[model samples]
Target: MRILASLQVRLPPSRLFAPTCPTRLKSFKPLFTSPNSDLPLDGDDDPDMTDPVKLAFARAEAYKRQKLQAQSQKLEASLSGNGGSNAALENPSSSANQGSRASQVSAPKGKPPEAEIIVGDPTKFENIRRRGEEPEKDDGETEAYRPKVKTWGVFPRPMNISKTYGGGKVIRPGDILETKEDKEAKEQRSRELVTAYKSKMGLDVDPKLIAECQKSLKDGNELMDRGRLNQALPFFEKVMKDMVFESELHGRAALQWSICLDSLQRSSEAKVMYKKLQNHPNPDVNTKARHFTFSFEAMEFMKVKSSYLSRTTGYEMYFDSFVDNKEAYTSAKTETKEAGETQILPYVVFLVSPLFVILLIAVRKSFML
Candidate 1:
């Protein structure tokens, strides 16, 4: 019994000390699987997860984007070239830009502007060059709309002719009519045309008036060149009267009139005119007038001196009355100097006679001694 009990205890100890089989940890599986998942059937196999459709779609989209990018780069290179065209290259049309991007990307290269017909009607090509209009893309369709250009013409009608239910004659350019009434009407029309363009013709200088004034001025200058002051004065005066407000003409007329007056021996009137012109608006006229006044006054003063000298001497004057001379006083001065030389001859005779008497007394004393 002791042996049996020892065996039983040993047996229990052995059983307790015996090695046990380790249970393998259950393999963990994620609820969401990868594309390459390979699961078995009946939840006992891995799933086969390969998405060929999605891969094909992704590759196709990448290729399309790459092609578009390449096309855009080519267009950019063309536009950056030196010979690049400027035919609305930077198109401002919003409508054209909002259309299909493919159409915009496929737009053709434009030609140079110098090669285009810019002078003709753009509407014939179904184009309008005005601003604020929509632009169209080349979609292989003819344009259906274009703006029209208009030109206006002149349609002149007769003036001052009362209209009636009767027929009238038509007048044309360079038409010849053999009637006095027609000539009068033609002249009237010419006058009307002149009146219409009168302002543009320059009021102070009409063609005919300028011709007349120029002729008169030319004739007056010719006469003046010939030293005919009297004839020149009248022509210049007529010019002044024709154009009264012309200060140059007025001054010239006044100067010529004074010149003629002086030539006619009318010193008082010449002096009066010159003094009046001293306050003239033109500086040249005033200076000329002042010189003339001084000259006249000098002549008058010299005349008074000559008259005094002639009266005091009680001799016939050397100068004549009819001489309209400006240098007359200078000649009178030479004559007065000659007269003074003659008065010195009387003093010379008296001195010589006294010397002779002294010589006679000296000779008698010497002979008596």
Candidate 2:
């Protein structure tokens, strides 16, 4: 009651002379509001009056603004020692009010944005190379599918590839970087097919070898005809390796192997096998091997045997195709390095110039001494 009396009695004399009417009390405005607030003064003048939700929002906002203004005045009064001493107070709410005043962003002007239709190919923005949706047979997959690969912790582990993604194969380069071992394994497997196969030349002295070779050859031939070069090549190779080199059957196996190799784009390996056929005991095999290896005579020979031989399309055969690019590339690289080494002017300028200058200095000093 004393505080209320003090507040009322503290009113200025100018405001005491003013008439205290019921209408004035009903339409009373705050002495001050937050500078940033755009709160509606009159309910009827509010633009959001049409929308009940927006009208409620505006009224709530106005109420909040009035409440904040009252609080700010209380805070000022406390600071000015009119209220209890709160000089050490954090005044977090006062700071927040200041922040709110500072954070007032200007309302955006003009019309609201409309959706625009994109022109031209939508595929230009797409990188979707997957042909079909990935088969999601996760139930069939093992619970823990750790790859059979050795990886250092310091180096990225192959298993770190996130399994969180939808089904699609992730190509990790760390899994495929073994150039030497992979090549050795591939070569070993290819050679193993040749040694392990039997009966390919047909009617071997050993019955078991004969059966194996014949089966291998048949399987290989069938696979080759069906466009399975990789599967077929092994059978032909096994048969060729099992049979005696001098035998006509062996030469036939070589011919088939070479033909298959040509189809498989392994013409270099095929040429090596074709070259060995030059030492074949059978005269027909010898001539055909030479014809296959010798590009000059192959066209004319191909013309004569075009009816049957024309079946293998894009079949390439060259005597020099027997020689791989490795040897030639190494030689050329060596020659270039040697040529570069012989031209030492740049090296002399960079390395020997200081030495030469030092030598001349020493000579001049020696003569002066």
lDDT of 1 by residue, 1-369 (tens): 878767743234433333232122233232224553222222232223224464355445544555455444444544567433442364324224434653564577697444334567765755444444555543534333222334242332333223332346666888754579977998999998887664432354656875676578778878987988778877877876765432555566677777777766676787887898898767888899999878767868877522122335543354444554655455888999999999999999998998999999999999999
Global local distance difference test of model 2: 0.64
Give the alpha carbon lDDT tens digit for every residue of 1-369 in model 2: 878767744556553333221111133245354665444444325232355565566566656667666656655565456742462254556645655542332234588876556478978846432445453433534544443345553432334245543235565866754479878998999887765553333333687887787888788878978988878877888887888787666787788888887776676787898889998878999898898878625746667433234554654556447774646445788888898888976887889789989999999999999
Each prediction's number of clashing residue pairs: 8, 7
Residue pairs clashing, model 2 = 198-212, 198-213, 199-210, 199-213, 199-214, 200-213, 200-214
What is the lDDT of every predicted structure here? 0.59, 0.64
Model 1 misplaced stretches (Cα beyond 4 Å) = 1-207, 300-369
Candidate 1 vs. truth: CA RMSD?
Answer: 26.7
Error of 2 at 72 (Å): 99
TM-score of each: 0.26, 0.25
Which stretch of 10 consecutive residues in model 2 shows the poorest summed lDDT? 19-28
